[model samples]
Target: MPERKLTPNEVSYSAAISACEKVGRWQLALKLLDTMPQISIVPNAVSFNAAISACEKGGQWEMALSLLRQMPHVKISPNTITYSAAISACEKGGQWQLAFSLLNLMPEMTISQNAVSYNAAISACEKGGQWQLALSLLSNMLGIGLSLDGTTSGAALSACEQVSAWQPALALLDNMLSSQLLPNGLHAGSAASSLRKALGDSAAYELLDKLRELWEDNSNSNSNNNYNNYNNNSNNNKQPWEDSNNNNKQPEVRLWEAGQPVDQQLAVPPEALAAVFDVLSDVPGVIAIFKPSGVTTEEAVNELSQQLARQRHVSESVDLHIVSRLDHPTSGVLPLALGAVGSTAANWLEAQFAGRLVRKEYVCLCEGPSLGLTGCQGNVSTPLHTVELDGGRASRTEVSPIGRQAFTGYEVLAGYMPPLSSEPLLPSHDGEPGATGHADEQRPEGPELMLLRVRPLTGRTHQIRVHLASIGRPLVGDLTYGAKEASVLSSCPRLFLHARRIELRDLAGKPFVAEAELPHELEEVLAQLQQVAETSPEDGHQS
Candidate 1:
């Protein structure tokens, strides 16, 4: 039988061009587009759109514009999709001016501009560092009564992040929450990025904690109501947190204290000392403490300073400065400096961090069975960077490649495969008051637990969390990154990371080391896991 070659028509050619576009073969797409005329098939708007999209994905800005310009010559009218793809091509190619020009031309061509068109233009502005222009577009959209979605808000946040405009970023975040729009990873990341630039590391972390608390309060209330409504008609109407096996057990009180103003919160009570912190070492000019989870490093420093003053009979003038910081939910060793040491000691301590002279070691319970990780010991050097999103727009934080060169070395201490629980978990990022998530699509399959000893070679914002998530093993109880739903299923109530050891040198280059044991929450979680294993050895399988 002789095989016959079917003639390529508009539909077939459009599909071929679309296939090429998906795979980012712009050149082939263009070739296929040109071949349509040779085969006597007049290219339609769909064909041009697919070709332009291919160029957009391939970063072929000029070719995309050329294809768009040629659309009219071929007697094909460019629609909004055609123009939007062309604009996106310019956006990706850093051709903001051209993108704006195309946007302006839409009105003259009697084509009404939509949110997609404006998003592309705003995104182009963001890429080009024209945040003012991007913001203007957003304001204009609102003036014209265009309803903003996550994408639109995300783009605006990204624009604010580009310029390190923390005030605007915070304002936008507050607006999103007040409007009951969910704040996803991008939204939080961008605001955090701006805050880090404006308020330094510790304050930024504290601010994020406050924001997350507000969102959680709102989300929990709304989600609980929704859950009650969902199960109202069922015979076994129950709260989501109620476990079947532990039906009779009293609800476990979460250790995470609701955040309060540092001024209003009283000094660390003597009876609550263990729950607050463990003093690792107290030297003349430096102090180290094991900060408990749930409290910001700044709050810990403030309270601990007062405690030190009372114990040593020193005046409050002995100003304490945070020499090392940990995320709010991260419990671990934190080093501080006494102001009496003056700027010399402060500069020296800061130098150690800047030069990576200090050794930071952490232990974390990550979501992994440790399979296909290559070995028990390995290093991850994934470029950790921030991304900002508003509405539907996104832009990477202006971290240079060099700035993002974060590195972490890890050794898997133990691997335990826990059975997947059939618990119905709420989305971790369900921060909006009224927004809901689709059922858990983040269930882990096999070995659901891994213990790792980690040493960060280079420090960046969320470096350890980012690195672990990049390697498919996000930390337990991490709402950000990929561990959201998994964290909900785990018994750990906070990010399962602890800064256990720190090695550094004091003034005059004298070497020293400080270590802190795991906090009560972390230790208790581990003890529970051990008890479970003791009772049910068949429950866990080695990965």
Candidate 2:
């Protein structure tokens, strides 16, 4: 009898692809995936995700994205695993922006983002030197109640390391310990290692000291004392990925050590619990507080709830509902509904934001005072879109035809040229030495900056930052959009945009407004600019 052959079904093809994936044979796996349809075997999500995993392990990012896009064309919907694998591939290939877009797409596609997907996207950002974005994503994770694991937490540390953000790196390690996540040897070492590269030996040792103090504090006080003992042993401090038998594997490489330019400078911020926010408004069933910069809206809410509980002399937990969220760098009027979960007060406030009945007002300081944007007030009705740029760090917001239509009305409040610093605050447009020319001259005329009162008719991720950047006047400290380097504005360590006011009608049909005053740091910056304007050569020195 002749040898009998069976046609390869989906199961057979999937198994073949899995084998290829296990062995890092990404090309073979892709070819098998392609051959399946040719052989009349329709590929499902399982087979496609397996191929993506193979590509991820083999660092085939472009192929992974292609496979992911092809799934929808074939009438196959991608699940969480599909997106996670594709994101992992992008991370391996240093395509952090692409990975972020895919993660964002999951929510739009009605698939809930899981810890795995977020972890992969964060790892990609870490690899791409988008430490700010990575930290922001980590903050978002807690808002959604996703559990942070070794992989996710370690990626955040790596991102801080990439930028030499020593303070945030240490803060993150301390956070992990407080969260009971146990800072592993790998993450701690990476933070220290990156600190050494960024700020020199003194900074790295300083970080090590902070880590030791944090470990000791947790050891002396935490109820789970056993978890604190891991840091005591010297020889057993192995990285999470290392094993006793696999001593031959070189540790993951650091990009900074490999001569890649640092992405951005990050200042060490005070702990969230230590921040004190001013009370803006105390309306019925609602209180508006001035949310400080450098903390997520969720963290602000948590801290505010604790403070309120303390003032009430209550030990039990209280549910404080956040009506709307501001970005970590954005300090603004954050409204909190003090009520039980699903209370009518919470629902009403939430409904206002959902229905776009709430009005928000922002004050921003931006570059390019000479630009015509400061000439008058008008509405910027351009539709905005978020996209992954190949030559850019993280994702960028752009004007696109298919993007969500947005409206922002703005009028220039004031404009001035601050005294030039001894060193340039913004990075030079050309990479050559002192392209800005402000760095070398005596009393050089600094870049013109303008303040604007902005009203966003539509809420979008990075709406104000992107809109302003699109009009050729990016915010002073907004490194992500169009702000030059952090050194450009040495006085302002944060994005010079503030959500000064918010207005809404209560559920009872009563109109109300909540507002936050300018932060002290912003006030100081403006004050200095005012002094410079008064003493400028362009203006007769006026008292």
Q: Once superposed on the true structure, which residue ranges of model 1 sit more than 4 Å away at CA? A: 1-6, 222-543
Cα lDDT, all candidates: 0.65, 0.67
- Residue-by-residue lDDT tens digits, candidate 2, 211-307: 3334334434554653443343343544322345645243321111112221111111123223466777665556677888899998887877776
Query: lDDT by residue for model 1 over 1-543, one digit each (tens)?
Result: 115666667998999999988876788999999888886889999999999998888768899999988988889899989988999988877788998898889989987778898889988887677778888888787777776777877778777776787677666765565555645545666666665665555444444444334333433455423211111233254322234553623222111223322221212233333444676765544567788888888889778767666665777634676667888889888887544322334434554554345789999887643322312476666555453333123323222332344668887665555545623432232222211222122224344466778999777777788776665667888876645754524566788899999987544334557898877787777765531121222444433
Clashes of each: 13, 3
Best by TM-score: 2
Instruction: Tell me the alpha-carbon RMSD of every candidate.
Output: 23.0, 23.1
Residue 91, candidate 1: how far off, in angstroms? 0.9
Among residues 3 or more apart in sequence or in different chains, the pairs in candidate 2 whose N, CA or C atoms overlap within 3 Å are 425-487, 425-488, 426-488
- Give the least accurate 10-residue stretch of model 1, judged by summed lDDT: 432-441
Error of 1 at 245 (Å): 53
lDDT of 1 at 133: 88
